[model samples]
Target: MTPPAGYTKAKPGEVFRLKRSLYGLKQASRQWNKELYALLHSLKFKQSTQDYSLYTRTQDGEFLVVLVYVDDILVTGTSTSQIAAVKLALDEAFTIKDLGDLTYFLGIEVHRNDKGIFLSQRKYIKDILVDAGMEECFVAPAPLSTGLKLSPEVGDLLDSTPDVYRRLVGRLLYLGITRPDLSYSVQHLSQFMHSPRVPHLKAALHVLKYLKGTLDTGLWYSATSDLKVTAYSDADWSSCQFTNRSLSSYAVFIGSNLVSWKTKKQQSVSKSSAEAKYRSMSATTSELVWIQGLLADLQIPVSLPITLYCDNTSAEHLPENPMFHEKTKHLKRDMHYILEQVAAGFIQTAHVSTANQLADILTKSLNSSHHHVLFAKLGLISKVQLEGGI
Candidate 1:
């Protein structure tokens, strides 16, 4: 094939040397990224380690976050003039298209209001629901039933014609960006994707039905909330019937806005509530330390002694006290790691009543009332209220 414009012609039986990277080449992405990163660095932008794609430059007390995805870049900052200057710099370096204020990126819809930025995958969810043939299905209050327990033995084998099960689960995984309520249930059903049974398919369909009702639901980042880092950690002992493993879950917030969270079944069984809770706290503490470092790099200063709330008081005490008893000795290693952070003033553990434990939603299924309360704490409000006032 003849070489196109901005390309060198190849000699007989020889490949054309690429002057600039293009898609589908082995090292094209890396080479293009190196060039972009070098240009940003020369413009006094510092790359973030927590998220390497995030680059920032602060001048005259204004902050700009330059998010790069291959050749596409999203620049968010305090001033339009500053953003324009950065765009000028990029234009001078390479061919670029400037897409004004981010409305869509990575499948999530961005909506801004006086309240703050609300992110949702409504269009993506609708598309998936239609693709799965569940667009008209009725919605349920929750993603999974509280009393339902799924096991490999519950249902018949799925059809052997094509791999419909794996494809469905993969699409649901992408839906998790705005629907954290589906995290645990999605992760559970994902285990059987290789050989999904009738029961697993039913459960997965139930999740789709729930999504049908809450298609417009998403995360709201409050503009008025203070930028203070606080986290809630909780665990459910022996929740997994298959492996008898405990589940650890944590939710981190900047004031009232939920920024990050996780739900994962533990590798090993915990004999006591304290052990389970300690493991959960350790996981949250590590995330807290990493977030602190990232914030430091962004020059966003935070107050000392970041607070971590735990529903188990025994676990909270275990970290601050060194007395190693029989019941606590088994968790000595996990205890010590979290305690080191406590002593270093990076994080401090505190006791929270289980009723007020927001992380409970992530660890186990909750009733409607409890779920509503936890969702409120996570900065999720009804779309009607979000649009009308609030």
Candidate 2:
């Protein structure tokens, strides 16, 4: 340790007194990350360029991967002995407790079988229900009601006693990790977090009701599924009644496994539905590029020209079209980005019917029957259905 800036006559071997700890400083996380990176580097592990939390190493055709989140670490690879050795070294340094196989991490529960792996949050859902005091609430066929209109000022403001609306919505946001079906509903309700109305509260409770029926539902990764990457992009033009901003939504899949999905409102208003869809396609393309880099870091090969499906024919042709019309002047940059990817053989755009667009669930509220159809196509399955081989 060095002496204070004003003290220039310090002893050669003198050290500053310990008044605080590295963990007590505001830069604790950054300091810890540097130390962890040094240790992993000493072990011949290279950090991922796509995701800083991920580390990987390969020796003698055996691969080892380490995923770190703060102090919690998830290690996996092709060799059990290699994993064990890595764990042994980590435990020696940090005094870690070996939890064996990953059955539960964060709030997600992992169930494994001969078929594949199923990730769920049944317990987390139940806890949310209890916290919301909706344990016995009636179930709804879908998370959000069809043709529902929710805005900032709809009804009387909610009581400020306990802030039930904000709390429930926050938990639902976390629950959305395993329940993509709640993406649209949760994102819609979250818009009113600052000043929630009675109608907004009721709508949030409706989402809880939907959760009651799908408590056991979660993502399933099939063992036999291929590694091909596919994506569905869709948008609801001027969906917000007040702001007139469109919603951009997309779903990404690896073979039959649903890996990522999102529903977000556009920052600026789009002039036409085609523009909205094009914006959604741009967001989806960015996600696909990140996924490609991540897979490369993991030593996984993905087929070139990843397929991107959009329901709008106009948006489909925008990527390959050579000319930009007068109405599309504002979208010139986006057009160039997509056109570059298309020209480089990184993405192939195609048109799909509205009925078959899986991302429709993330854009707007739909009827019960249609919502259920898209839900099933998302590779979501309940534990009972999985056990029965349904």
* TM-score top scorer: 2
Cα error, residue 234 of model 2, in Å, equals 0.3
Q: How well does each candidate superpose onto the true structure, as a TM-score?
A: 0.92, 0.94
lDDT value for candidate 1? 0.83
Q: Residue 146 of candidate 1: its Cα lDDT?
A: 85
Per-candidate RMSD, Å: 2.8, 4.1
Cα lDDT tens digits, model 2, 1-390, are 778888978798898665534777787888778878888899999999999999999987999999999989999999999999999988888799999999999989999988899999999999999988989999999998898979786688886732888989999999989889999999999999899899998898999899999999999999999999999999999999999999999999999999999999999999999999999999999999999999999999999999999999999998998697798989998899999999999999988999999999999999999999999999999989988885
The C-alpha stretches of model 2 lying farther than 4 A from their native spots are: 1-25
Structure candidate 2, residue pairs in collision: none
Off by more than 4 A, model 1? 1-20
Query: Roughly what TM-score does model 2 have, to 2 decimal places?
Result: 0.94
